[model samples]
Each structure stands twice: as structure tokens, then as C-alpha cells.
Target: MRNGLSVDVEDWFQVGAFERTIDRADWPALESRVEANCDAVLQIFADAGVTGTFFTLGWVAERFPALIKRIVAAGHELASHGYDHKRVFTLTAEEFAADLEKSRAILEDLGGVPVRGYRAPSFSIDARTPWAHPILAEQGYAYSSSVAPVVHDHYGWPQSPRTAWRPLSDSDLVEWPVATAHVAGRTLAAGGGGFMRLLPYRFTRWAIARMNEEGHPAILYFHPWEIDPGQPRVADAPLKSKIRHYSGLAAMAGKLKKLLDEFDWTRADALVPAQQERARPWRAAA
Candidate 1:
């Protein structure tokens, strides 16, 4: 029951409030940062002998074909992350569908791979928009890692099943929620955003290992910005954003390397084989 890893490919400035400030016109400079950041991650994976899924924003794929090509060439799974980083709940079905198609087509063209998986920006899929699951299935996405089952001010579906499950909303879209730490009847999120940054590495390893024991492989995800301490700071960023994005940046790479060394990890798509039975119902859901 090896765990899985996924990286959401985006620049540091394009996150949260900065999204409002950093216009599409500013993307060229952002692309340079994206390259250096992703290069470091590629090196990290190479050193650890680990492979991971990279859910890239369509904006990045369209602008950086070479980067997308390099990711696929390196034997990692390529997946869509919507056209821009727009929240799914914020978009109408038509808008969401268009974005999904746009992102999928761009990724397929650039990566030269069957981009079967997707992850909502900011992990924003929740009960507020169950429509997203079916839309993803309709768009031919085979799996999703967008549900974070813990409560958060921004995005979380606390009552959502922690283990991978086929939502009634979509048979073809297997919902892979982020890893969590179950303690004394409470489920604590283990990885992603601030949780990955602030939490100790041992705790994450133990939580993920415990999840594997329960027959659910952990899915750990992060962004390139999380490892870049020198990233430009957003002015008047929300207190929560400060904590979630910048808390432990300097330590992230080392912690990530330790995690790679200690755990049995592989790309999310690799788990598709072992999770075939679990995901089979999803195929019908589509």
C-alpha cells in the first residue's frame, strides 16, 4: 500500500490574493520563476528516485510546452489543473466545462500523454458544488485529488470520506482526498498547504503509514512555492494565507526529501493499478 505524491504546478505569485494582483499580462516573468521552481522539484525527485503526478494549470502548459514535455519525459504522470486557478465553485457548469476542456486539450497536446486526472485549484471541491465531480467525469477525467476532508476556512469538506471513494455525483471520477491524521476520533489533515509546512515530518510519515494500514494509500500534494522561501510576498495577505503559504518554506525541501527517503511513494497514477477495484465503480459513474 504505497502512498502517492502530486504537485500542483503554478508560480508563487499566482496564489490566493496575489491572483487578483498578478494579471495574465505578468505571466512572462512568472514563467521564469515556474521553470526554476519546477527544475528544483525535478532534481528532488531524481535524487529520491521518486516519481510523482504533476497537475499543471493550463496556463502553464500553454506557455511552457518544454516544461510540460520535460515532466512527461521524466516519467511522471501529467494531469490538468483547470485553465486558470479559478475556483470550481465560483464557475457555472458551462464555464467549468469549457475550462476543463481547454485545460485537458492543452495538456494532452503538450505533454503527449493521456491527461486522465485533475485537481481543483486550492483543493476547492466540496458539497457546495457536487456538480464538479460529474463535470470532471463528463470531461473524461479518470481521477481527482481535490477533496480535502478536514475543515478549513478556505476549502475543506470535513464530513467527506477520508479514503478514496466513488462519489454518487460521478461514477468515472474517483475522488482521492488528501491524507489526514486520525487521532482520538478526530481527523487531522497531514499534508498540503500549511499542514505540510508546519507539521513535523515524522508525524506526516506516521499518519500516512497509518492510512496505508487502513487500506487507503495517502495522497500528498504541494506546490513549488511551498519550497521557495525567497518568493515575493503578497501585500496585506490574509493572516491565514501568511500561515498556510509562508510558515515553513525554508524547511520544505529537506522535509520533503526526508519523506521521500522514509516512505514508499510513487505517482498518483501508479496507484491506479492497485486501486483498480476501488476506482472501477467510478468508471461506471462517468
Candidate 2:
């Protein structure tokens, strides 16, 4: 099975982990490392002969147009990760719509491709954010890989289906919820992000294999910063945030290379035809 691979293109400081410590107002003055970090990720994919989607932030695109062009030139797909990294649930309907439009426009302009997909920052769309789906559809997004069906302090929609489905029955938008594996009558996140970094590689490999055996293509995601172990750290962050953001940074590159070698990976857009064909009619939890 060809699985989906994605990179959330944002700098270390832009991550939700440091939101409390790093204010948006100070973003302009901060040193930007996303260009170099993302370049490292792009090189790894190129070396492995893999192409994947890049859910790039508008903020990053605007600052690093050359990086956006580089990703596009490499045959990767371009998608929106919102203008800033604000969580969807925190934004009002209007604010979310504007953010989506801004991000999509910026990505399309820089990448020279029709931006058809979106991944909310931190997987922030949950039951409280039903308004997000229609807004996405209205703005012409074909799919969204924004729901993580597990409990977390940052984000999740545990009651949502663990696979791709239509969250809005009245619209054509497909909701590609992040992958999870059923184990011991519970759903364990088998995708990427902190779980992939923190858990044993053996566990992640098994989880993806289990999902694939069950006929679901796993959608895995990581950040550009994951490969930059030596990137500057947020010194004043809380202990928990500090741990989540910085742990396993050095090992990530090796694990990711192993994963790319093991799986037949492709852009998230490549999965669209199959996903649309298999999509079930469903609604998100209220």
C-alpha cells in the first residue's frame, strides 16, 4: 500500500509547544530556521525518491518563497497549514475562513499549484469546530487531514472515525482524519508527530503495518524541525512542553529514513482518488 507522507513546514518557535512562551508579536524579530531545516527534509525525500505533501504555513511561505519553490520543483504537493499556526477551535468562523484563504492564496502563488488540501495546525478541528468544514469547502478545499482521533491536551476528536470520511454530509469535502490502530479495544495513534518521536520505532512500524494489513493507508506527518536536533531550544518553556518539543530530535532523521525505505510513500494528493472513492458518508461528533 502506498501511504501518505507529509511535512508540516514551520520553525521550532512556531510550534504550539512554545505558544505560551513565544508571542506572535515577537515572531518577526525571531531568527528564522525553517528554510534550512526544511531543506534538510527535502534532501532526505529526494535521496529516497519520495514525493509528499507539504502543509506549509503562510507565514513561512511569505518569508521563504524560494523554499516553497524548491518543494514544488521537487514534485511535492503544496497544501495549507493556515496563515499563522493558530488552532482552529480558537478561531471564530470568520477568522478561520480568512486564515484559510490567506494561507491557500500564499501557497498557491508561491508553489504555482492549485492548493486543494489543508491540515489544521496541531490538528485542532474537533466537535466544537464543526464550522470549519463548511468554511473549508466554501473556500474550495477538496480535503482536510486535520483531525486526530485521540485524546490530547492540544487536540483530538476521539469520537471521529479513525480513517477518511466526509465530515460534512452536505458538502464534498473529505475529512482524512489522522491514522490510528485498533489495539486492545482502544484506538492508539499510529501516525506521526510526538507519538512517533516518543514511542519506540518498533511500535510505530508495527502500527503502520497493522493498519495497512487492515486496508487503511496510513497518513504520517512530521515537522521540518524534527530533523534539526541542534536547533535552538526554548529555554523558558514548561518542563512538559520542553520535553515534547525537544525529545528524540536527533533520532528522528534516522527513524524517518528507515520509514521511507520501508514504505511506498507518496503525496497526500495521490491518495485523493482512492480516498474519495472509499469515503463514507458521516458527520463529525457534535
Candidate 3:
């Protein structure tokens, strides 16, 4: 069973964890480690003989076009992570549309692909963002890995289908909610990011292994900064944000290599073609 592997490419300073502490106007002054961090990620995947997708920020690509080209050169799918890291929930529908189109244009120009996929910053597309899907379809995105199906203070729509599903009856744009694990009868976030980084590796391994045993494919994701333990710290950020963002940076690389070696992996586009027929519309939450 082949599963989807994804990298959310953004600089360390741009994360939602630091959103309150770091001002957007000050972003240009912060030194970027994304290019080097992403290269290390590419090397890790190469060593494991794995290929996957990258949900990249247009802000990063404009500054590191070479890195964007490198991702495409190494057989990874190139998709949007918005122009800046703004969550879809924060933006008005028109603002979201502009951000989406701008990011797709930048990535398509640099990566030389159709830019058919999008993963919102912070997994921000859920019950509240009903307008996001139509704009995504109109903008020509084929899929979005932007919804999480577990409860969380930041984001999740637990009632939404745990598998890929169409958001609209009329459009082909499918939503691949992040994979979850049923633990003690409660659904938990198991599709990487903070969960993969902060939890014991045994848990993620068992979760994915179980999903595979059930004839299901899991979509696992992590950011480039997760493996760069030496990344600059956000000193004044809250204890919770600091812990979530910085706690397990060192072990992330080893975890990913083991994950790729253990699972059959492919780019998200490859998985979606096989899944389109199986995907059913998820009714928007009232």
C-alpha cells in the first residue's frame, strides 16, 4: 500500500506558532534557513529512495527559486502553501482567492508544473471556510490536503470524513483530510506536524502500520524546519507554542527516514488519481 508523503516548506520564523511573536513586516530581516533545511530534507528522501509532494510558500519561492526548481528536479510534486502563511480562516474570501492564485502562479512559473495541489497554512480549511473550495476549483487546484479531522484549539473538523472527499457536488477538487488515529476511542492527530514530532515514534509507526493493515493509505506530512534543530529560537513565544514548535527538532530526521523506508510512498498526485472514484462529497457542517 503506497501512501502520500508531504513537506510543508516555509521558513522557521513564519510558522503559526510565531505569528503572535513575530511581526510580518519584520520577516524580511529574519535570516532564512529554508533553502538549506529543504536541501537536507531532499537528501534524506533520496537516501531512502522515496518521492513525495511539497506544499511551498510563494514567499519562499520568490527568494529561493533555485530551491523550488531543485524540489521539482528531484521528482517531488510542487504545490501551494499560500503566498504568505496566512490561514484561510483569517482571510476574507476575496483575499483568499488572490493569495491562492498568486501562490499558484509563482510555483507554476518556478516549478514548471500545473500547481494542482494546495495545503493551507496551519490546516486552516474546515467547517468555517465553505467558500474556499469553490475558489480553489475555479483557480484550477485538483486537490487540497488542508483539513484535519481531529479536535484542536487551532484547527480540525472531527465530523468531516477522515478520508479524501469532494467538498462540492459539482467540482472535482477533492479534500484529503489529514490522517488520524483512534486512540482509546478518541480520534487523534496522526498525520504528522506537531503530533509526529512531539509524540513517540512508536505511536506514528503503529498508527500508519495499522492503517495500512486495514487497506488504507495514510498521508503523512512535516515541515522542513522540523529536522533543522539548529533553527533560531523564538525566545519570547509562549511555553505552549515554544514546546509545540521546537521540542523534537533533532529526532525528526531519523523518524522520517525510518518512516519512508518502512512504507511504500508516492507523491500526492499519484494517490489522488486512484482515489477520485472512491471520494464522496462531505457535507459542509452547519
* TM-scores, all models, native as reference: 0.91, 0.98, 0.98
Q: Write the per-residue lDDT of candidate 3 for residues 147-219, one digit (tens) a residue.
A: 8888998888888877889888988889987678887878888888888888999899888888778767899
By TM-score, is 1 or 2 better? Answer: 2
**Model 2: per-residue lDDT, tens digit, 38-146?**
9999999999999999999999999999999999999999999999999999999999998998888898998899999999999999888878989988888889999
Q: On a 0 to 100 scale, what is the lDDT of residue 128 in model 2?
A: 88
Reference-based lDDT, residue 144, model 3: 95
Task: Report the C-alpha displacement of residue 161, candidate 2, in angstroms.
Answer: 0.4
| Model 1 lowest lDDT segment of ten | 277-286
Local lDDT at 227 for model 1: 88
Overall local distance difference test of candidate 1: 0.82
Worst 10 residues of 3 by lDDT: 277-286
RMSD for all candidates, in order, please.
3.0, 1.0, 1.0
Cα lDDT of model 1 by residue, 1-286, tens digit: 6789889998887776465556767767653577779989999999899999999999888877899999999999999888889988898888889999999999998888899989999888887786788888777777888888887777888877777777754354588887998899988989655677898777887888888788788899988878889887766776666676788999999889888888888999888655645753332212
Error of 3 at 14 (Å): 0.5
Cα lDDT, all candidates: 0.82, 0.90, 0.90
Over 4 Å off, model 2? none
